[model samples]
Target chain A: MADGTTTAELDAPGDLVSVADRLDGWLEELDEPETLVEGRREAWERYRELPMPQTASEEWRYTDVEDLRPEDFGFVEPEAARSVEIEDLPATVQEVLAGEQDRSGVAVQVDAGEVYRRLDPELEEQGVVFAPIVEVARERPELLEDRLFSSEVTDAEEKFWTLHRAIFSGGYLLYVPENVRVPEPVHAFRYLEREDAIVGSHTLVVAERGAEVTCVEEFLSPDLEETSLSVGGVEVFAGENATVRYISLQRYGRGVEHYSVQHATTGKDSHLSGFNVALGSDRHRADVTSHVEGPGSESEMLALWFGDGDQHIDHHTLQYHKAPHAYSDLLYKGALTDRGRSVFRGVIRVAQEAQLTDAYQTNRNLLLSEDSHANALPNLEIEADDVRCSHGATVGQVDESQLFYLKSRGLTPLQAERLLVFGFFEEVLGRVPVEGVRSRVRSAIERKLGF
Target chain B: MADKLLEVRDLHVTVEDEDIEILKGVDLEVDHGEIHALMGPNGSGKSTLAKLISGHPSFIASRGEVLYEGDDVLEMEPDERARAGVFMAFQYPSEIPGVSISNFLRTAINAGRDEEDEISVFDFRKRLKDALELLDMDESFADRYVNDGFSGGEKKRNEILQMAVLQPTLALLDETDSGLDIDALKVVADGVNRIGDQNQDLGVLLITHYQRILNYIEPDRVHVMIDGKIVESGGPELAEQLEEQGYDWLREEKEPVSA
Candidate 1:
């Protein structure tokens, strides 16, 4: 195991290492197991060696990542482990947070790297591990060693994941032992405090054989005033016959910039579903990929985003079928108002050896204003002739007739437009099984719509 | 004259992009407590007239004045017109996906009511329940998205439910009877009739391509519009005569005037 170099070793004139070095110093004190330390060291070296992705790269043709230099932002260290005051948040955020607490069985609040509170002690007694990433590393080194910073099954050669692996400061780590079923969802909340402050966090989840767990990660900022940066990575491992539902709601302030990468793998007969709701951020990018590594595994991916003002949100999803008889489905939808812009690129790939694979991808966008824009690209690649793969994309504005119908019933045009946009988003939001999480997402969407 | 609900004087409207004048110098007046049925053929501009009165942005009113409760409605926005007690039940209502019917209705009701006096959630729920009961709508419908995945009959009934809740002074039923089965038509007409009976001062401008809805909700006056103009006017018997003889006789009578 090795610890990464200090700021002095990496910083140079006109180089971004000075900011990166500051971030490194903040993470240097985080406790990690020997294996994880070694993995992170290797990841840091790899990040230094890898080149930033450019628009010329086929994988990043539609995305412009050159503007995301590290020098543009400063590193944010956890100043004080202050409890998040819900009353200080926007009414929409407060309502959503309160609603989730009322409905969910387990709620864990992570303020920066600190775990402020954890609900449902009984479930914690049932061999369910829910704690800060640092504690998890110290308590369950074996599980962390096996999965932490592991990129063998996923496509992690990208610059963003490399940087995330090298610099992630604090995150949540959840583990469900064999044969245990968690009825209530495990919640993780991460709050970003300063604008233009870089935040790199990682979440690792493992569910042993026949175990079931649901985890929700919420990202929020104080308001849309700061020009911040958040790069997050999450990895999920579902053991044989296990089931895991993961939801990530990124409701950053409008001034923040965000990039996220989530990779998940499922074992034989395991089921995994992931949802993402993007309501805030001036510019946001999310790249999520799921791999069915064992037969009979199933993966479902759903996303909904509402972009307003000058916000820009981009989402990319991939479902890779590596084992035979695996099923995967992806649906992403967004509504753009004002001059906001959004892009969605989704792909479903079935490997040659993955016979009898079933894969589907669909992306839909609703443009709420003439000035707003949306772009969708859906692709499918099938190497196995017996496998079924399909993809589709659609971009459209709200139907004027529908708006008229609502307006005729005394709804103002804005109210009618909001209703139509909400309806357009329902296709993806409806699939979320957790009522509280779904309501929270709904409230966030309404708030973004200025309801 | 003081009790007149809607008065259209020389309302000239043109269908966008086409030289066709759908509502050509049409004159009509509907008084409070009266149900006026506007019957015409496919190209008779019945729908256009209804749209013009409701302030649809697409319709260009070249020369006309639409007075709703004695105010010029031609300059008003669609929502403004609605708030001013003008309502039009669409022929094909748009389906809104994520918004629940309950939320949509409440927002509409609140927007139409006094802005300072917000209705309580309990009171709103009570009102919604009463209206839904009147329309025979299932309780589940309130939770479902507005008009999303609704059957044709269900959508029409929902329109009437909205009308009942809004309680507009001037209700324009634009082809409300179209695309509905006989059973659905009766249910929808019954709902409209109930609203009319309950709000006796409500004035209705019922626009229809067929006379079937007239059987259940009898109209006090009937007017035949052809080629964007009111060609003939009479009592309810005119609707029956046109339904029986078709617009062929009217077309022949108007063809000479065209030359």
Candidate 2:
């Protein structure tokens, strides 16, 4: 904090492993409760003991993270609470604020830049909590203690998750009390536009019995330079007969290396939707899962991405059915252009007790450039004889007849191509349940396409 | 620059990848304000000539001259040729999902106009609405995707609607009468006749296997094509002859020349 630019602990640069080794003490100092300090200490020790996942690991086969040196990134403050007024925001944000969208609340986190939160008064009166997780931890410790780091992804997870749990700088928590259904969606805008920085952002949502809420979280950046590392995790807890819709849109700058883990655990007869749209990031890997721990639960997982330039996007998903009469459907679609590449690996696992389970998974890719490539692996593991599971994957170029038809109508080649690509992506984007989030996502994709 | 509205001379065309010639030395001409029908048997290369004139990538015209309004139509891209007022109604129009009819039409309408002279929303909407009514299309059809789930007759009628909107100087209708019932054929024929009345100087080259469409929209001249060449040229009475007595007699008559 000498010059107020770089923090004291991260001021000195070290090699990758050494920097990975030294982040624990900073996290320990940053925690509020002594319990979190202990949690950070133990998680850090475990993170050090575990080796980083490599290309040799089957889960990381197509991904290469060797060039990501830990010493090149460090945590910085999100500047300050500068100009939180709606008009002073980005044009997209301003446009969103202009209309009276169905919104319960909105929060904007700009890098270590600034944080602005606006909670609907009526919703807040109804005991809907949308605030920093730290505040929630202080006010309602019991609610978070049992749920924090309780992801079914397991304690022995990959290195990024281990690091995230160890030193996650900031995150949000949304809590909907029993039977208090929220009518509008909660918007969270997370902007990471820092130079050579590491950001660990997390979000946790808990919907009690019969409660319903939708959360839309988007990652953004106006100006990006050098390299930035983003480690994000989102976990949802749905109680009996509750419903939760979670949308995560990552359209960060191309100078980013983003890794995310999103998972949800649903109780009896609950429904959960985890939608993801990854359009930016030079290299990105996202692993999303739904663990149906209760009977008669259903989960819908959908994802859409358009990779331009030489960006490499990789996605892995899981539909883990541990209870009977569970249902899950997953679809992932992408369009690649100009040497861009994408890989999709998904699995639907039904346990023996999960009889009468139904699951389906499909992945489709359209190649807009000859050199672009798509790799898909959709797998199913069923231990129950009474379960039905199916998976399909396809990779092909745009239909030639479709192109010729548009061109014959006087559209230029590039315009005709972009229209087809957008049509291909609509299958996934159109499924988003939040209207504000959907339009903002559309605009983001439009901007990325340079239209 | 030239009195001839559309001219084709010594056209020798083949599929791009193969040596098999589809059109061998085709010669035809259509004066302004005239309608010419190219009646041919199946696989006789009538559609191939239309595709070649519009610069379709699949076909290569090895030797030919196609002059449209004094411009070399063969030297242009399909889109450029279309912008230059040479229209080709596809035999099988492609389907595009998620692109609404309104947006597609608006884009096409704007593509050929200068930046400052781009069609205004009010004018474009008026034109589209008028065309939609003329085609008997439901107003809500404006929001539907282009040809994605259209019936055969609907797709052909839509093609005619596009031709009316574009107001091309020359139109090449390839099998527009195929796969259509009498009612649909009359509707499509009426749409073409409407275009003819609106653009009196327009020239049309209508290619069809059957002369059924001719009963509604009369052709000024008729040319019988076989084995990629125009074997015979005659008046409207020839279509009636072909309709009553199929193409076998003509095939036998042109055996020596075709071989």
Candidate 3:
């Protein structure tokens, strides 16, 4: 980014939106190769052409983004963070860093830049590349140049996609070569400490043939007072016969507005499964997709969300089957409390050549209060008659019979409801392959339920 | 007579939000060390009375009173009633997936304990072992999710196991033998019989639709119910008479003498 410090791009007074106009400085500052620098310029051009979504836009009809006027938010410096030592971190981060649980490695990121990362010496000897993208650019420039701006997501086609490309700063690059299996999970934490600053980062995970790996990334905010913004994206590449699991947990404070796009591409005979747990954020929009491009590929997409207060959480997913004998399943479950609201929209598409494909999508929501709301839309498009695809969704309140059953056993109404809610989430959380992340997600859910 | 374990005086209960009176002025009593069988035909409001005593919100107790050892229980919450030692083995136990039986039962036991008298882990384990042996249940049963994917008879057995662990003063069995084979029936009846023998002051109210379960666990008193009211109260022979002639004779007797 530009040396050390730069003034924030304050929007003009009385104007509702023009935040997208500040992308010129960010795009010019991106440290990139000559070939991709041209791509970045085009991305900026397309971003200018792409219109910010209005309230009635079909892409976000279920969610109203009218309040997100560009004039209300401004972009901060790429490395705008007040560095803190590990011991001076929040108790939550300290507890995680104490190494009570087994992890392959851990990295701490603030303001889209990694401050500290530690990996086992054995992994370095084994030639596993786990480091921040900037370090990767300096040490392994070709690897970053090849995969940096090249993802299944188009740069300027969608507003969020274009915005992510034009203003993105720093993120993680996890590479596991052929036949290498990381025995334990790798962890990364992303946070923001400055008020009225915006962070856009991208995470890329490329697993070579026959590789197996699991990585977890969490997002946090130091305070919940002033408005902050975070725009992030993830791309996972699972090579032939490779198995990859990537989990992203977003718990930004209430004053933060978050947007992310998580997508993965699986090749022949590969398996890709992960989780998206969106627990906090005043307004969150996460777009997650899985594309099965090779024969015998499998993809499992799972998500869990809890929206309390007036929080608005949105999750959109796409399962694209491109080759024969591919299987894809997506399940998104959420619980809404108080005046909270959530939206889940998932689509499964099987191309004509994708015969013998099997796909299923389901969304289940539990409304803890009458004031809360949940909208689920599951769509499917099959160009092949031989494919088997189905979608189902259900929205209801806490089961009265189940609640009474618990209360009758001597638990109060609150305890019974919480237990039942936990049970409701267990069905999908059980699918989380990594034990450590699963337990962390469990504790987070418990905290949400307690509140 | 020994101290009264439970007393019901002219109890009247109706379905909440509707004028449908399910338990119409029913009166009954069970003293210490007594086993009472409440027998009735299908749709005879037998389950309603069981739910009423357990303080189910769906049932409104319009009149009368329920006293447990001289304290009024009608005003208490369901959980309060449970903590006060009133246990009702539901006819259809719920399946709580993802929660193991051990955790659920421990919570129940912990809820019933006084803050200062919380059971130690050693004691809880010992009690669980003793109860398991008394019920002839396997060790794996404690780890399984509570009633989730359990067979009909297994659910009934789980109910008895809860009773064995809780050791309530007044135990209400609501059709606990309806869906059991003869072997499963013996296991459940044997467990209740052993509990009764051990706790001589414990009172048992076994509600059943048929006389099959009464055959396994002999009762000190039998009451015949029809149309939400008890039609006959006598010795164990009352259950035998209803099993043989069915509720037709009781219906004929319950009606006023025609003309």
The residue pairs that clash in candidate 2, if any, are: A77-A112, A78-A112, A78-A113
Worst 10 residues of 3 chain B by lDDT: B106-115
TM-score, prediction 1: 0.88
Residue-level error in angstroms, candidate 3, position A411: 0.9
- Candidate number with the higher TM-score (1 or 3): 3
DockQ of each: 0.65, 0.57, 0.63
Question: How well is each residue in A203-236 modelled by candidate 3, as lDDT tens digits?
Answer: 8898989999998988887556877788887889
RMSD of each: 5.1, 4.2, 4.0
Instruction: Please provide TM-scores, in order, for all candidate models, with all chains considered together.
Output: 0.88, 0.91, 0.92
TM-score of chain A of each: 0.87, 0.90, 0.90
Residue A144, model 1: Cα distance from true site in angstroms: 2.6
Residue-level error in angstroms, candidate 3, position A311: 0.9
- Writing each residue's lDDT as its tens digit, candidate 1 over B1-259 gives 3746888999899877778777889999999999999988787788888888887768888997888888888878888898888888887787887788888888887875676787889988898887888888887889988888888878888888888877888899988888889888888888898898899889999998888999998999999898889988899999899888998898788777654
User: How would you encode candidate 2's per-residue C-alpha lDDT over B1-259 as one tens digit per residue?
Assistant: 5668888989999999999999999999998889999998999999999988877889998998888877788888888988878888988998888778888888888887788999999998898888887777788988778888999888898888888778888999999999999988888898898888988889999999998999988999999999999998999999999999988888888785654
Superposed on all Cα atoms, model 3 deviates from the true structure by an RMSD in Å of 4.0
Proportion of native contacts kept per candidate: 0.87, 0.55, 0.53
Q: What is the C-alpha lDDT profile of model 3 across B1-259, one tens digit per residue? A: 4447889888888999999988888999999889999988887788898888888889998999988888888988888888888889999989988777877777788775677887888888888888899889998899888899999999999999999988888899999998999999999999999999889988999999888998889999999888889888999998888878888888887797878
